[model samples]
Target: MTPLLVGVLGVFGLFALMIFRTPVAFAMMIVGYFGLWILEGSRAASAVVLTESYSAVSNYSLIVVPMFILLGNISSAAGFSRGLYDAAFAWVGRFRGGLASASVLGCAVFSAVSGSSVATAVTIGKVALPEMKRLGYGDSLSTGAIAAGGTLGFLIPPSTGFVLYAILTEESVGRLFMAGILPGLLLMTLFISTIVLISYIDPKAGPRGDYVPLSQRFKVLGRAAPLLAIIALSIGGIYAGVFTPVEASAIGAGLVVLLAFGTRAINFAGFRGAVLETLKTSAMLYMVVIGANILNPFLAVTHIPETLGNALVGWGLGAYGTLLVIILAYVVLGMFLDGLSMLVVTIPIVFPVIQQLGFDPIWFGVVAVIVIEMGMITPPVGLNVFVVKGVAQDVPMATVFKGVLPFLLAMIVGLLLIIIFPPIATFIPDTMFG
Candidate 1:
């Protein structure tokens, strides 16, 4: 059989495995292993798996994943996320749809530490949803805000998306993280603006909230200061060249651990739970990374990415036209695939095209991550929407999906602005790393 045919079969087998409920990690691993065995010898295939698996597990830069996850997990366990949420509510809960706005803000803040959308949504939803409901905030608006806000975790600093993108493309993690800073904040602002527009159109949908006095607001802010400080020091430190990503992760994790125990926020049991959860998440991410690494070499041997890049550029579309096509394809893919799966499956093919078109990789990373974040809330398989529905079980699934529509549009707007003005995503990274 021709190598091109082998590549085609391998792609189908990968999808078939996913269809049959094989874990994405293992699905990629299996296709990669046997694809190599067919093309190379069995000995080479076996060696590739072992070497790649070990390489993935032992990579020094990857320590950021586990440490950052630990920081977020421990912060949640210690109830620090609650303090952050309350502070947000205190400041913004008085305006029309302020509760919803505060939820988005809380998600953005918590995302700085958590870096996982589900965790951010769950953490904020638990604290924000009940209050919004209590204060007569509409389920659609409130739940939608949290659901969309939670995706900030994918774009903010220390993002899992950036980490995976870096790993796949061999880009600088710090530059990618810095690149996301402005765009993440922009998306967060757009989400808030959407809430304001919705509330204005249907004030009853998100009634105005009670205002807190200044002294009381500051008091609540004081409660949230520790986590905020840690977020600043860890993420800020990275931007300031004070620490590498690995050191920043360790410092952030260590500080959160100390804050948890030192303030009596968590007992031994809670600490254990945080550690266990971190291990599970970190292990899962590591496996996906390993799977991608293995699968990529196989794809290269098949020359699929090269072939695909050639095909895309050969379509006679100019650079921007090709990019538009790529973005549209991602939107379609996002409807069915989760964010991590999309990143792993598509970036190898897409990254080459991106480079060919002369788009900045860091800027495209932000663009790609925002698109993935949109997928997290897109219908048919909106992961974050499902997560929000899970949290607000009394709220109908349809309502949750309905709620995210405005935010979804807001994400698209943010995406367009970035595309039109690439500097929104590139300026910070360029200034910092230059």
Candidate 2:
């Protein structure tokens, strides 16, 4: 068969494996290895697998993955997420929809330390959902806010999504982290605004929270100070040029561990559990990286990206039009695939087209993550929605999906603003590094 035909078949086979409950990393690896064997000789394919596996594991930059995961796991085990929620509630829980807004703010703050969207959703949901329910908040607003806010984990600094994007595209990790800051904050604001608009339309959906005294607000802020300091030191150090992305991860993880021990928040068993979880998460990410590396060469051999890029350019759509098509594809695919799976499978094919269109890679990284965030709350396979559903067990699945709709619309608006003003994602990186 022709190389293009082989590439097409390989894509189909990969999806089939996913459907059969094969892990994404292994599925990509199996398809990629066989595809390479067919295109080249057995010897070349064997060498590719061996070398790619070694390089993926040995690459020093990949250390960021496990370290950041450790930081998040440790923080979660130490109950820092509760502190973040309390602080946000103290500050924003007095207005209409204030509890919902506090949930969004808490998720955004916790996301700075915990880079996983599912974890952020689960952690914040367990804390905020109960409070909202007890305070007479509607399920739609409460669950919707938590699910939508959880996506911030991927867009904010220290994001695992950004790290994976950087690894796949060979972009600067530090620059990508910096690029996400403004956009992350923008999305958070949009989420909060969505809650406000919803509550305005139906005040009973989200009643005003009891007023918190200044003394209590400051006290809660003090409780959350350690987490705030860790975020500042790690992400702030990157912006100030005091640490590389890898170094920042190390510092962040180390500090969180120390804080956990000093505060007696985590015992030895809890610490060990955190380490084990980090290892498992990191190993899974490494396998996906290896699979992507092996598949990249096969895709290149078929000239599929070039062919597609040329075809799109030949169709006479302007850059923005082509981009719209790509974004729409992501929204559709997101209904079937999780964010990381979508990223690993599609970037090898779509990134070439993006580069050909003269778009900034850093900006695209932020934009692509925002699109993935939408998938996390979208129907059929919305990961964050389900996570929130698990927390709010009495709330129907449809209700959670309905709750996330406004936030999804808010995300789309935030995405459009970024697309229209690319500098919103690029200015910090340019000013800091240029």
Candidate 3:
């Protein structure tokens, strides 16, 4: 059989494995190893598997993954997320829909430290959800805000999504981090605005929260100061050229650990748990990275990306038109696949097409992340929506999904703005590095 046909069958088999409850990493590895064996030989397949696994695990740059994960886990154990929520609430909770808006802001702030959408949603939801419920905020608006806000974890600096994208595409991790800042803040603003609009249409849906006094606001800010400092030091160090992305991760993780210990927020038992959780999460990520690396070569040998890129080019859609088609495909695929799965599966195929169209890789990285973030809240498989549901178990699934729609629309608008003016994603990296 032709290599292209083999590649097609391999993809089908991969999906089949996924449907049968196979882990994505192992499924990709299984398909890739055997596909390579069929095309080449057992010797080459074994060699590829060994080399790729070792290389993927040993790559120094990958250290950023665990460090950042550890930072987030440590922060959660320390209860820093509560401080972030309190600080945001102190400032914004008095206005109409203020509690929901503060949830968004809190998610955005916590995302800077946590770098995982589920963590952001779950952490902020625990704090903000109860408060919103007490204030008579509708379940839809409260759950929607938290779910939508959690997506910032994928777009903000220290993002695991960006790290994976950089690993897959061989782009600069620091540049990708820089590129996400403006777009992250932009999306946060849009989410907050959506909450405002919702409350404006029906004030009862989001009753005004009690105003916080200046003394209390400052006190809350003081409580959150440590986390804010960590964000500035880690992300800011990258911008100032004081640390590489890996170094920044190390610094951030170390500082969080120290803070947790110094404040006695976590004892030895909690610290041990954080380390164990970090190892588990890091190992999972490493598996996916190794699997994608293995699968990439098989796809390359089969010339699938080349064939797909040429086919798209032949469709006679101009650059922008083809780009739109690609974006639409992501929107559809997102309904079923999680963001990382969609990203790892498609980038190998679509990135070549993106390069052929002359779009900047850094800018595309930012745009692609935003698209993936949208998937985290999209229906049928919105990961963040499910995460928020787990936190707000009393809220119906449909209500949570309903809550995310306006925020999703707001994200679409932000995506459009990024497309129309690429600098929205590119300006920071250019200004800083160039």
lDDT-sorted candidate list, best first: 1, 2, 3
Pairs of residues clashing in candidate 3: none
Q: Tens-digit lDDT track for model 1 on 1-434? A: 87889999999998788878898999999999999999998999999999999988888888999999999999999999999999998999899989999999999999999999999999999999999899888899998999999999999989999999999999999999899889989999999999999999999889888889999999999999989999999989999999999999999999999999999999999999999999999999999999999999899899888888899889999999999999999999899889999999889878988998898999899999999999999989899999999889999999999999999999999999999999999998889988
Steric clash pairs (candidate 2)? none
Better of 2 and 3 by lDDT: 2
| lDDT (10s digit) by residue, model 3, range 1-434 | 89999999998898888878888899889999999999999999999999999988888888998999999999998888899999999999899999999999999988888889988999999999998998889999999999999999998989999999999999999999999999999999999889999999999888899989999999999999998999999999999999999999999999999999999999999999999999999999999999998999899988988998898889999899899999999999898888888888888888998999999999999988899999999989999999999999999999999989999999999999999999999999999899
Relative to the true structure, how large is the alpha-carbon lDDT of every model?
A: 0.93, 0.93, 0.92
In angstroms, the error of model 1 at 366 is 0.8
Model 1 lDDT at residue 188? 90
RMSD of each: 0.8, 0.8, 0.8
Q: lDDT (0-100) at residue 232 of candidate 1? A: 97
Q: How much is 15 displaced in model 1, in angstroms? A: 1.4
Q: Clashes per prediction?
A: 0, 0, 0
lDDT of 3 at 261: 96
How close is every model to the real structure, measured as TM-score? 0.99, 0.99, 0.99
Clashing pairs in 1: none
